[model samples]
Target chain A: MLILSRRKDETIIIDDKIEISIVDIKGDQVKLGINAPRSVKIYRKEVYLEIEKENAAAARSSDALASLGDLFKK
Target chain B: MDNDVKQISIPSGLYGFEGLTKFALTRASQEPFLLLKSLEEESLSFILIDPLYFRPDYTPDLSDEDLKEIGEEKENNLYALAIVTVRPGEDPQMTANLQGPIIINGDTLTARQCITSNPKWQTRHDILAEIRSHQGAESC
Candidate 1:
């Protein structure tokens, strides 16, 4: 991981397409403004990880879904 | 290869299963639950549920970028299916991932698991409890 120090209002450009700007800085929280192509998907690291973890757990329980058939009686 | 199988292509795939772009959507033995079987890996599959079936007010606020990626506009023939997770034991518990719903475009059959910006949604929503609560409200 390349770590670079940037103060507020500083911007980092990736591949000359994606731009990540440091919008605001409070004591601990740092707000970011990202400009990227529509194809690029942006997400918070923790939110993305949570979805990944949930997907993995859901995949593992596929066989157990048969038991749930009784719950939905329509 | 079944006639009932609907081919779905997720260019970016799911959060964890990124390499798997192709999948087959088929109805499970259950009425509402659907099976999302990976075409690349035979052993991998997931049970999907239409969140709106239980949570009638479920409206995932999809970003324009996410919609464009799937070649769709907001709510234009889009089917949002939540991945179901079943916890087995003496009393089995089931939950659905509402935070990241698998959004499929009906026309093109393209799909993507989109993460909503709403903090109210979460990875695990108690399916049975939600149903019971709905039933409890109806009786009043």
Candidate 2:
């Protein structure tokens, strides 16, 4: 991992296309502003993980398949 | 064989799976999770699918003009959809997006996922995985 230290208002450029800026800093909290193309998708890590979890959960239930198998077999 | 069984007809268009009789999801320690299952129809097959398989960021593409035609607010109201796959044996197979979650006006069943900003759905999910799981279970 490439780690760098910078103060507020400072910016970092990635691949010449994406930019990350430190917008504000408070005790134990820092706000970041990201500048990326529309093609780039940005999502909170927690939100993404939550969605994935729900999708997997909904799929695991066997009620749908059990009913279908019974239908076709008869 | 008696010929008194009534034939059921499933609509050709996409439909929401509000009450599927059976469905299951499989978790692989190293591989992607799989959803598989069957429906209540005798000749119809339902495939359990993971929404992530279709679109990582599944947003409906809609223009401002399109929203006006339906009298819908762009940000406040949008449609989502999911796809489901069905088959009737080793012949022709059909798949539907069970993600996107086709949004419809509560008052009207007219539905479409052609546009929306929701990114929590998928376009395609496989069915064969579910069949294998069920078959494997029955053998044991």
What are the RMSD figures for all models against the true structure? 3.4, 15.7
Q: Which stretches of candidate 1 lie over 4 Å from their true place?
A: A8-42, A71-74, B1-3, B74-76
* Interface Cα RMSD, each model: 2.0, 11.7
What is the lDDT for B91 in model 1?
A: 75
Q: lDDT per residue, candidate 2, A1-74, as tens digits?
A: 99999999999999899999999999989999999876555655654344344334444332244444443343
Candidate with best DockQ: 1
| lDDT digits (tens) for residues B10-64 of candidate 1 | 9999999999999999998876789999999999999999998878889998887
The DockQ-based CAPRI class assigned to model 1 is medium
Where's the lowest-lDDT run of ten residues in candidate 1 chain B? B67-76
Q: What is the TM-score of chain B alone in each candidate?
A: 0.93, 0.32
What total of clashing residue pairs does each candidate reach? 0, 35
In candidate 2, which residue ranges exceed 4 Å CA deviation?
A62-74, B1-80, B83-140
